[model samples]
Target: MKKVTLKKNLSAAMISLLALSSFGGTVHGESKTGINADAAILVNAETGKIVDKYNEDQPLGVASMTKMMTEYLVLEAIDKGKIEWTDTYKISDKVYQLANAPGLSNVPLRAGDAYTIKELYEAMVIKSGNGAAIALSEAVAGSEGEFVKRMNAKAAQLGMEHYKFVNSSGLSNYDMLGMHPEGTGVNDENMVSAEDMATLAYRLIKDYPEVLKTSGTNYKYFRKGTDEEYLMKNTNALLKDRAYSYKGADGLKTGTTPFAGSTFTGTAERDGVRYITVILDAKDQYGQPSSAERFIQAAKMLDYGFTQYETVQYTLDDTETKDALPVQDGKEAEVKITVDKPIKVRMMKKEIKQAGVELKLDKDKTGEDGKLQAPVEKGEKIGELVLKNEKEAEYILDGLQRDQKVNVYASSTVEKANWFVRSARNIGEFLKDIFG
Candidate 1:
């Protein structure tokens, strides 16, 4: 894998993108409401920005939604040539034993049974089959533990600071004989934050869209050998029930464990706009509907986001070069930089000009000239510009500070040479020209 880095500095274009007044006009200051879930969040799927949040940072158990990450790694393995959809895998004893074990969702695989990767994938995703999860993990990473390592590593790469995985099947914690079994601690399962769940959902839908092939299916049948066949049903009821009228509701994972309660990662697209919502630990005190309650809360949050916000682009012209700072001992003393593309902000028409932009530069490494130099690879940053409105300022800053900074970068190359070498080379050129 190749490493790519970005440097930004946005001091000059502080009020470039934020339309504070626009949002203030549209967003009527409504009273804050509480939901039944322990944690919940709604995010713009395209920008990965949090539109609404509650306890988003707190880590909580994510039930079968853990399968979403499992699905992601499986798809990644297929892309990397480690496995293929048509590849066949033999069911190991360990996997079969786990599948047959009491109190776990499974696809009912027998030891020594063989199934294709595509078949098992459907079982894992649509049926929430724990056996298939284990089988696929073993096929890809040679062991479930190793596959989990990859999962955690991928989470870290995506900035999921509060997530950990102990099993691929998400069946780590179970009560044996009404008492927590010895060595089967409560901490053995997967734990994640609402923000992290959203991040993972975004990656799954954005990067590995092919996984949805099976997840969206309402039912699938697996043929084991010529005489044996079993029908698997989707655990998610939204596909079956149309009354909810969830527009563009599509394939995603759901999870429920005794310890984890109920968890869901749902995605919906309307009029070309997509959104992902996550809810964890949603259970009713009485017999009231918990999943439905969480879904309603998510729908409300999403509606608020889509109705009130839009992504708008603001261009910082290359002609706006007055912000460039002076460089020492370089061919070009200064260079101009501007925003590469228009940015999208959620606001109304009245607040467009009030947005703030902040730019941040990468590490300022000195060059070979022995002067303070920038690694001025074209578009290297001079500083950052932040765009904020009155509300953002009030929250980000102590009071109503409107001005913010956006990043500036070098538009052209700046060449530097050692003093002794440059002096000698200039003399040699003069002598050659005059003597000739």
Candidate 2:
């Protein structure tokens, strides 16, 4: 087995991909955000910026949605040299049992079958196969219980509020071991909020965009060296066979269970911008006995996010703050610094506004009062550049309430001087300032 550290959600884990500010990112105002599902949320794929939401914080069965995290961990392991795409694992009695278990979603993993990691991953994500999910979890973490522990830990690390996992497959209301043997009665519904689902989707797409390549799949898959196969129709109706299909719609996962109702974490791209939306406990809005309320709502929400909002990229002036600040007791009286990276924020384009930037420094760097004192080195972190809304007195980004803080470093080295020389330089600077 290979060891891999799970990452927080992409916004939190992939700093290079999405540099969420410390105050988070500042939005001037809220957008129209309401959904019909029991819970739902729409977010920008790049920024993890929420455009709108409703009951997104309410916990409920995530069903096969749990497989998203499962896939994340598996891919994470493979990416870190822990496992290979072709690595294979033998089917345990548990997985085989799940295949034969009536009414449970599975890809028919017969006993004595050796399945490759990639094959099992597809079954879990594309088919929502419970057996394949357990097989992958056990292979990676040694046991389903241990695998679930990693899931919860990763969820918490991703800043999922009050989320919990009982099983890797999100099979709820069933005995934990009923399918495999070592069983107990644990109502592990795989609880998660719609907002968390959006976060999870954002990270998966941000860090593993490749996952979308398979989201369009709607078919029955076969295990390696096995003659048996099951029709693996994608649960996401928008992907195919529906009136809700939209341009740039691609891959994502859907989960449904007796208790979970119908839930989906969907993604699509339009005009160079991608959007992810989550709908939990969806309804049959059109009155079709099998109406795909999930897909309909998902399409509506995703469309709203894409057409109503846009991600803005702003670069700091060519230089870091562009001006050198006085440094006490340094050979050079002042030092310059540069912006570490450009700022990317999600905002509405209706009435665009330039994001406000505030440069903050450590008191010590500023000597005692708000001035810098030192032998500051080039590339040393002196402070951070914060992004704020011009209307901060009235608004904020809906979900990410914190301001964004980018690390600012000293651009040049400034060495300390002899006390006499330093004192003389300070006096001259003071006298010059006074005269000016």
Which one wins on lDDT?
2
TM-score of 2: 0.72
Candidate 2 backbone clash number: 14
What TM-score would every model get versus the actual structure? Answer: 0.65, 0.72
After the best TM-score superposition of candidate 2, give how far the Cα of residue 55 lies from its true spot, in angstroms: 1.6
List runs of model 1 lying over 4 Å from the truth: 1-33, 175-187, 224-228, 240-245, 285-289, 313-341, 348-436
**lDDT tens digits, residues 302-385, model 2?**
878777766666544623455567777888867877777876665667634655567788665776667777889898888877
The TM-score that candidate 1 achieves is 0.65
Cα RMSD of predicted structure 1: 14.4
The sequence of per-residue lDDT tens digits that candidate 1 reaches over residues 1-436 is: 1111110112112112211322111222321335567677777676565666676766667867888888989898899998989999998877887767677788888889888988788888988988798889888888776787888888877667667676777764442122222223443557777778988887788798876667767777777454557788776654545334355667687787655566777777777777778877674767343766555666666676677666555445322333454455455555556554444555544566675444444446343543336336677665544554624421111221234344556677667756875577678879999997
Cα RMSD to the true fold for all candidates: 14.4, 10.1
**lDDT of candidate 1 vs native?**
0.65
